[model samples]
Target chain A: MHMLLNTDQSLTQRSEHALKDSFLRQAVQFTTERLREKKEESTNALGDWELWRERGRQIRAHTIQYLDYYLDQFATNVEQAGGQVYFAKDGVEAAKIALEIAKEKRAKKVVKSKSMVTEEVEINTVFEKEGIACVETDLGEYIVQLAKQTPSHIIIPAIHQTREQIAQLFSAEQGKAVSTDTKALTAFARQKLREAFAQAEIGMTGCNFAIAESGSVVLFSNEGNIRMVTTLPKTQIVMMGMERMVPTWEDLEVMANLLPRSATGQKLTAYMSILTGPKRSDEKDGPEELHIIIVDNGRSKQLGDPKFQAILHCIRCGACLNVCPVYRQIGGHAYGSVYPGPIGAVLSPLLNPEDEQVQELADASSLCGACYDACPVQIPLHDMLVYLRERRVKTQGGIEKVAFRGYSAIFRHQATFQWMMKTLRHVQKWSVKDGSRWSSFLSRLPIVQGWVRSRRLPYSTQRSFREQWKMLQKELEEGVDNQ
Target chain B: MNREAFLLHLAKQLGRPEIRNPPKREQIGAPDHWKSFVLPRKSERVDRFCQEARTLGAEVHCFETQQQLQEGLQALLTSLKPQSILRWDHTECPAMIDSVLNRWKSRIVDPIADPSQALHADVGITTVDFAIADTGTLVLCSDEQKSRGVSLFPAHHIAIVDADQIRTRMGEVLAEFRGGKPPSAIHFITGPSRSSDIENDLSIGVHGPAVLHILVKV
Candidate 1:
């Protein structure tokens, strides 16, 4: 999910191209709108959606604040339940561990359900290099894998692909032409994937939540692919973020209610599977070996920082994405990361922290606070975006410093500020465009070259509101004197 | 790696464990007013739960005796509209559904032994131990008596539930598991297999049971 796209062009350049794509814009808009409507109805139907969201937030916030304890407890419990747990400091380490496991097991084919962390660590590519065949069992992941594209949506990975594209993918696999009809295409994929399920030597999954109390991993899936992955294969590997732990199964109940409803408006996902460990001495179907890898790729950085700590509370429900005006306009690819939308805007730069490269990503937000309102755990994403911008400027200490100093100097002396404004008014007349002042000057401003290149700014009015208000006040005083 | 080395590594990475204050669990699900919500009768409860499950495309049946259940299943298999039917090994107990199902001409066996055979299953029959009325979840405990594949591996799953085992809420059913030495696996199924993979357009039975039949016998 953290594949580094060559940042050859600036953020502005990439965003400009994304904004101009008519198809991408319409697709993102229409999809988010429908998703928003469904989310609203589903949450309302459950009643007290906000309360549920708050509960989800509280649990996440508490767990992350005490992450060290919960993670330790989770590891201890996993071991107690007859499962092995690994802690990975970063993506490279995580990938190394997984690859080593695959080698040890002599895995030929690995079947994986959709896992964002796996995407982040680039596990499939790692296994592929080692000559192990890794298959994505999730239908969306399979479609995108065939298309040779990264996932465009968090929940719906292949949302950007048309039905015809899917039909085409299936047709190639089937050695026959297939129709774009939903049923026809899905039936073909269903039949094709069953072979991969039975043949895979290892199965991998992403944990939705790891309950520490019972030492169990909880997975929520509509397709039941996770059930197949964990149950059918001889070995099961679950890659979980360190922040995914909840204290108990009772805590999991709250998350289960919030996540599915906010994510897809399902009263409940069709399947909620809780795996305690591998198949026991007498059990028949489950995997013989179980491993849970808890990863912390830049998550610990937010632990003590009060401003950004709430970011760790995210349930990864994608609710923020659906409500974001910026994301609905530019779509996911423009963010240039696996996570997209407001959550991505805040998270990507923080995780990567290559200041020279990611400063503009923080500026990509509109600061509308819609993401905060939609967030299941109420992560203050818009405020975090503002904080990131401030942090970027503070680190630079160039134009931003001089610009603020000059402004503060003028404000301290009202006479100087008035004179500067009057002088600018006179100078603006020469640069006026057609009757609107300052338009021509703004278009030519070197500092705003990127902004004006893509979008046109409104010209200043003939008279400032301050000037008009002053004139009206003078007239009122004159009438009062006459009376 | 052995569990001991794994635990030590995890402990080192986690650093010092923080002293956690007692958590303030929020008023979590269903509003305060709705906490006392209850449906009037078993029929009403089952009907409402079934309706919601059906909206997700699960099938439903109400039967009085094992013979009626078998007849319905026999018709389903004979049609072979789907081609195969997967059933749990214990579902074929001599005095139960098996006594009647033995008369049918379809392949009915424990799916775990030959799971690949479930690919073309016209119907999958398994007995659920309990039902949660709050969430419409059918709970299946996998052990020697039951195979998880009967509920999961097939195209269409016919889950048999006794009317007396229906509980009022998920908490009640969950409480049952906590009291006992729980089984190896506990699966909570609410509806038919479904996915909205293609741009939020839901496709039922994509990878699991397309049709889910819950039989509540009186």
Candidate 2:
């Protein structure tokens, strides 16, 4: 997480690094564009997409409203199924529990499936510090791990890596020449991961949805790493965001419809595994001992709060990221958190409130409502981004506060508003350079620069729309009087 | 660790204000229009649905007579060359099929026999009580003959569904579950065990079955 910190390197500097790499830019753009196209095609294929979104929203809202009941029921079921449940208040506590579990197991090696929660808690770095070997088993995760880099996209972790770079990574791992061919590269990854799956002392995964009634953590994945992770290892630990719960198997059908279609435009995930408590007494292949860590880590704080509560409904589909202009251009690295996109813009700031590192993340959205349109659950992420910005202003003692104050002052007095408009008309000349306007100057000026860098004002009309409307209305009224 | 303390902690995290019972939700699952989607005859619909399921990568077989179903089972059992097979609790399948399999040194047992044992078995045979035509989902309820782990865990899973049991919508089968929650476990299987994890490479059979054969009997 410290790598995410060091605001000394702002999103601009990081995005600049990503932009300069032609391969990285092409790869990210290709994947995001392909994913966006798939989403459009799939949503159109599924008639009444809006109805599905609404049903999804209804279930999420209902489940969140009664989270306590559902979470308790889920916990009871997991326990009854012979799984231990631990509720962590925050990342520190979550990491602490993970470290303790590792120590208790005397585990020298751990194989992990792709889990954003693990990244949030910085578990790999923690294990590294403890001198435990942690290997990422997911193919995308393996590429990033080889590069000593964090995941750049939510669903496609190595979206930034080109085929050439992957070949290079694999070549170095093998200490021999490796082909850049996709099949050969993938086969290499399979061989490497198959070894890790066989030998790892502990297997860890993220929970997609936990069925409270059945004490089952449902995992949806295209890769079979999660299955191998849960079944082959002796001990399996599932780290679930506290809100990743549904009332029953009945609710799972709704989520099943929404998640895969939203994530990758699949009719259904290739493998959807429901693990009910470690291995039952009669079970042969599943984990012998199962531990489910319900990590709150700033999620419970959103409960009942009307303004930001709907943010919890996110199934982490990555559809929002694919459609987001900011994510499409700057890529996920700029967000510098486990999550990225419109969802990340709100989630990161909310999760790490007041941490100067993520405070500016809320400004990354264009708020065009494209994300809301793309969301399977219809979470109004654009509105949530605004709420995060509002909350940030409410808490800060500096430029954000002064910026809002100046904004409010302009609107409070009509004279000041008109004066500011006139001043901005004269001041706007310098911004228009050779017909293409320069926006970076406006952003670099002060605290609000992040917003300016991402958006451009089309050449301002000769008169304000409000002024034109008033004049037209006045003329119409006078003509009527004359008649 | 203590139940009372855990409950208190969980309750507090829920923002322990006075308990307010929220309104009961009516709108859940697929929309009403989807639930109302019905096909023509069960036999013809089952044939079309099985074909569709096969198109999505599941192996499908249609049997006209009970003897034909037994013949198909015999052929599959001989080809697999397994020492043991797991059978689900269902009356439609020939009772002698179990003894016949046992004679081949492939002993048959009830569906719920431990998953580990199921994993080691050559094949698992169960009669799917219900199937959905739309998404190619088979609904398995826990009973004396059917164990949740049979269709899953094993190298090969053979499911038999009476043609009349096939439905058009997934909801119709889920409603059967609502009547009294049949067992601790219920599974909806759509297609073959598949994975696209390694660079989007599609591989069949990772942890679950390598082959799934569904026999539709009229």
**Number of the top TM-score candidate:** 1
**Please, what is the whole-model Cα lDDT of each candidate in the order they appear?**
0.77, 0.75
Show where candidate 1 strays beyond 4 Å. Answer: A412-416, A433-444, A453-473, B1-17, B20-41, B65-71, B78-84, B91-94, B179-182
The positional error of residue B78 in candidate 2, measured at the CA in angstroms, is 8.3
Alpha-carbon lDDT of model 1: 0.77
Best by DockQ: 1
- Colliding residue pairs in candidate 2: A223-B197, A284-B116, A443-A449, B83-B106, B88-B145, B89-B145
Candidate 1's TM-score: 0.91
Best by lDDT: 1
TM-score on alpha carbons, each prediction: 0.91, 0.82
Q: List the residue pairs that clash in candidate 1.
A: A1-A119, A1-A120, B84-B121, B84-B122, B85-B122, B85-B123
lDDT of 1 by residue, A1-483 (tens): 255554787766777888898876877787788878888998888778777777777778777766666766777777877889887878888888888888899999999998988988889889999999999988889999988887777877777778888899889988999888888878887888888888888999998888776678888888888888987889899998878888766677678778887787777788888888777867768888898888878776776677887888888889888998888888887777767888888888777675467556787788999999988788899999999888888887788778889888998987898787767666655565333346566667666654665565444536766788999999999999999
Instruction: Write model 2 residue lDDT over B51-129, tens digit each, in one string.
Output: 7678668889888987888888888888887766776645655675665566665366433344345446778888776
Give TM-score values for chain A, per-prediction: 0.93, 0.89
